[model samples]
Target chain A: MSTTTRMTGRRIVAIAAVALFILHQDFWFWESTALVFGFLPIGLAYHALYSILAAGLWAAAVKFAWPDHIERFAEAGEPEGGESSGGSVRS
Target chain B: MTPMVIVLCYLALLLGLGIASNRFFRGTSRDFFVASQSIGSFMLLMAVFGTTMTAFALVGSTGKAYVRGIGVYGLMASASGLIHAAVFFLIGIRLWSFGKRYGYVSQIQFFRDRFGSSRFGYFLFPILVGLVIPYLLIGVLGAGKVISPISEGRVPPWLAGLVVCAVVLVYIFAGGSRGATWANTFQTLVFMVMGVVAFSLIASKLGGLQAATQQTDPAYLSRAVQNVEIQTREGTLIREVGVPPLMFLTYFFVPLSVGMFPHLFQHWLTAKSARSFKLMVIAHPICIMIVWVPCVLIGVWATGVKEIPPLAEAEAGKVLAMMVNLLVHDEFVTGLLTAGILAAIMSSLDSQFLCLGTIFTNDIVLHVAGRERFSDRQIVWIARGFIIAIVAVTYVISLVAPKNIFDLAVWCFSGFASLFPLVFAALYWKRATVWGAYASVASAMLVWFYFFHLSEYGHEYALWGGVMPVTFCFLAGAGAMVLVSLLTRPPSPAAIEKFFPQQLEIDQ
Candidate 1:
């Protein structure tokens, strides 16, 4: 992917992940009486699914939103004086 | 073996571990405070995970789930899983880079440098310490609550609190952050394994998952409370068992506290490289699930267990231990499970204690009194002195000012969460000014104090009836940052260039 396209894709993913987090806080499952497999409450089960989805979203974030400067810094290895190169892009 | 003996043996093992780590200590202030920035990814993951999962996750959550029902999981656990990892990815990585660049060992140092105001540490140092003391109390109180019941009156609660405080102090004092990290990694494994074991055993003993759910009130299964009559000492009392929706929604802000914790800042600095944070970010939510789901399930099960009596608010913290004793006939299993609970509690206490000491030694003593005067050995000793003093103060407070572990933790996290806007803005917003940072701190503290005072009268009290105090404090802090910075001049271009170079380049 082109640099700009990848950056835009990351921005879109970041916004979507944040929106998903906000929507997760709403009380949609609060009144649901359904139970998952007849044991877990619908609310409890909803959060369990949410936790899985969150894990996936965070993995995506690591792949995309991760700052390229950090990747370059890691590749360059620790600087001689232990100072981070100030010229790198900000995260 | 007796539970007290088991606990004593565990403490002995911890002391041995602390003493052993001392041999590996490099005898430098850097090694003591930031572990020489030598920690690998796996150890970093364990240290971060262990520190975050405190007594609040195990004992308090179980007790809370018993009273509030399954909604307890949603209140903090599920949201925390995602929010903590997100914070780690966004805030932690950036801070690690800065700390690596600037050699910052504490949050105070970071703020002082970022805002170009040494005196800013004066305002921040007190608020961070004041907030951490209550957080320290949560661990001490939780240790007492777990040990007191399992020991069945043989060990006094004060003695339990003292033992935990002393054990944690020895390791942290002897070996510093390296010792704390080693201990936390070990304890993390112990508690995670035993948490699942205890959960599985209790569920099966109660006659399987389906049978357990059949016994619970249907209303308790959902977010809405089931009004149930409990047999108290005087008479039957009606109690609400479940969580309120709005209060639950607002708890989303509480987990954001991880972003602003000074101890976590110190931990982030200890990372060998930025990549070390990847293991922490990816596995943090999974680790939260591993530890929390069992505790929440056990807590919800406690509500329906016919053998266990309905618990009053004060006694509810003991629900985890009560379930262990009531269901498991094996004394050995009970002791091991209790050790697991204590493991979780002590893991956090050691880090908080050490972080506060680091702050005092580096930010206050070295920075204010001048670093040239004190030798590196003297600096380490100064930090050890502060750790001992803080532990003693917290132990005494735990005995006198007893509160529920979960409630105290929430209030503590709210204080940190309220300050999140300051850190977030300082890192991300190039226009954030020193005055704005001050306003954010002042506004957050003022709003937090008002709600904290109100909570003392009524535990259920919320700002404007529904919103949690954290929501208001976070907004007020963030709003003050934007408004004050816009009204005032932006930070100096040089300062912005130093921190946000890429943004400055774009602006030009």
Candidate 2:
């Protein structure tokens, strides 16, 4: 089994996302009048699938490219002090 | 009559929930603004997603689809899904950490601290508020457009806008961000579920899904070109093409606006943990799919429905309401769906209202006026007062405003998208200086207004050949930032060290 480095994994996801953006144009489907499931227009069907794919890509990005360093930085900071709750919530 | 009754009840219920949520208010300026950073994954998903999905999704997209065809989804939802999440991952998370580390409540605060310029707020604040006013108006206007038809015009559009603004104001006034999150979570569910139900009900009324789509003109189903002359900044050319490839391609930049939305910035800060963003990011595209597919389909389907007839130029925004009222015969269901659509609109409204108030209180009143002058309680009151004023102003403006929800949203989104460069550079580019940031914003607005003026603010305006004004505005901002930053001194190393945690880690 091969292990993926963080940078390589991020690059792969980034490239894939860019690829998806290009694919989003869907020129092939744009002029096609065909319907998916006999109800969905080809352009609409293509975009629906594309949106789901984009969601999947984001999930992958989150898993692989999560900025762990920022979390560490925020955590290392001293806790916030003196939260005041006396103010009114109304005008 | 029954539908009207139900919608009234639903509004009353929402107001009731706002009062209930206020009981749990932590009663602090921070809690009022960002819910004291206590929102979890699901609620964070709901609030952020709900805020992003405004009248633009339901009313605006439907109207756009009615005119432009199903390509509206391709231009908007699919693109937003990819770009918005990327923004959240890169910009949102990093800023959230900065916010938590420094007790930064507003985006302006982060910008001021990052660029080491207090005067930056004077320029950025007005731009933000101006852009956000259109966004806020979108919700109020959408609710008015939809509600009147649902009630058979028994309730006037003015009254509808007034009721929505007032309800959102009351809730936000009491519950603040926490109430907004709770309301948004509830409304998000209402709209998503009801959206599917409305989709099915409408399609069934037209025979079936296939039959309903068949009712649409084929030209309205495809993204093929149409011959239409458009006014551009250069001058009007007798060119004959609509939704050209360049225009379609450039539409991608428009969704990048979410990266810079003030309301969205405030919502990002409300997350309880960094991990909470995962659900919102991953699920956002799919959630967009759920809402947009139906609304766009319904809009296109309205073309063939005899019940809907034809709409005048100004009547486009009312298409969604017309369809729901005419097709779905169940009075109870219509009322429920009206609440659902209002749910979609109001969710964004409350957040925008609260965000602007937070900005006014934090950026101008506290930072500019000097914090020592006002008591903490007074500061809270000022936030509440500002929110009321905004809601009031928005409601008044909505009355005479243009009814083209789609065009209004595009222009608003374009302004924010144009500013995305400054935000991106501020976060990642250590060389980004205060002067460069100012140039970026100024260049963006100048270019944006230039195109807008040439178009006469027309709905169908385009640039050089077919690209939207946003494409040029975004480029100008990016170009100016790069050019001006190179010409100017780089940000101080101490400022870079403050914003760039990796550097701080290395130093330690």
Best by DockQ: 2
lDDT of 2 by residue, B1-508 (tens): 8778888887888898899989988777778888888899899888888999886677778877877778888888888888888888888888888777777778887788888887787779999998888778778877877788777788898998898888888889999989899899999998899889888888888999999988877777788876434333456634332257887898899989988998998898888878888998899899999999999999888877877756643566678777877887678888888888899999999998998998888887777566657776687789999999888888888887776644666788899999999999998788888889999999999999988888777366776667888888999999999999999999878877777756334222
lDDT tens readout by residue for model 1, A1-91: 4567657767877787878678676477776767788777888888877887788777777676656575343334343222211122121
Clashes of each: 0, 0
Residue B187 local lDDT, model 1? 88
What's the fnat for candidate 2, on a 0 to 1 scale?
A: 0.54
Point out where model 2 deviates above 4 Å.
Answer: A1-4, A78-91, B227-242, B400-406, B503-508
Best by TM-score: 1
Residues A19-80 of candidate 2 have per-residue lDDT tens digits of 99889877877678788999999889999999889888988888877667677776676434
> Interface RMSD, candidate 2?
6.0
Q: How accurate locally is residue A38 in candidate 1, as Cα lDDT from 0 to 100?
A: 76
| TM per prediction | 0.93, 0.92
lDDT tens string, model 1, B186-208? 88988999999998888899888
RMSD (Å) per prediction: 3.5, 4.7
Off by over 4 Å in 1: A71-91, B403-406, B457-460, B503-508
